[model samples]
Target: MADNSKARVRRLMPEDAAPYREIRLEALKLSSEAFGSSFEQEGSQPLDYFRETLAKTDVFGAFVEADLVGVAGFRRQAGTKQAHKGYLWGMYVRPVARGTGAGKSLVKAVLDHARERVELVQLAVVSDNEAAQRLYRSCGFVAYGHEVHSLKQGGRYYDELLMAVALTLPST
Candidate 1:
């Protein structure tokens, strides 16, 4: 949140795929403990991989003075198992842009999409990632349970807290 009034948010375009991938891989690399995958696992994914992901998902980016500073993505839960829900993923705000409402804006953009279009939004945050957990909670998410050793990399296990926000409330 460098300057709240200076940030602009828009749907991520095909042209943004490359820069998006670069920053995303950087986040995974630098904060693997807070994420499910390692940098090595996703760093090698080509720009085309991101292009394909963008093609299939609802993605948005926050720009500050024309520089991409934050990104968040929404994807539908697949199959008959959970088709009514959407998954929120790939959320990141540049270190300098955090805590200035840019993160809040990015989250609101995701929730805005889900509320009118999808029934539920689900996300997983690493147990020790307190900052992210606080952000999500402040944005209206509620945790149901913890998935122990939910993800493993580099010979260590990381726990995940499962969270969800209901986009539509039940009618009285």
Candidate 2:
């Protein structure tokens, strides 16, 4: 595995939606238990959906030598009562990019984006995914609760651990 220190992390633009869709499908197919959406469901969506999502959500990508290798997404809660919160969603690092700084860089990018507009950023991890749990914890996320049977794939139920990180404004 390549070390992630050299990876370039940046916010993805609308033009990058195609590659983002490709990698997202790859993630859903290979790591079904880790995400709430299924490959079948997302694959059937129109290209416009992906483009619109990319244009609106705070999605970040990690590139290694011009090849996109990882992705993370953040979106602020959309309501008057929930405006202070955001969600950390659709996090994935390509197998080849694992252990490289890609995962951490993507997370840092998401949290940095979240801090700009929300006071808390929340996410969920498959209860059994230790590596991902560790990654979130390392990013300062802490477990707050568990959602039993949060997702069902192939008739199997998967539990998800809810986690969140409080964002503090930088002191002037």
lDDT winner: 2
lDDT of 2 by residue, 1-172 (tens): 2334678999999899898999999999999889878899899987778889999888999999998999999988889999999999999999998887789989898888877788999999999999999888988999999999999988999999999999995655
- The Cα local distance difference test for each model comes to 0.82, 0.90
Over 4 Å off, model 2:
1-4, 170-172
TM-score of each candidate structure, all chains considered together: 0.88, 0.93
Write model 1 residue lDDT over 87-139, tens digit each, in one string: 89888888888777777788888998877667899999889988888889988
CA lDDT for candidate 2: 0.90
Q: Candidate 2 has what TM-score?
A: 0.93
- CA RMSD, predictions in order: 2.8, 2.1
Query: Which lDDT value does model 2 have at 49?
Result: 82
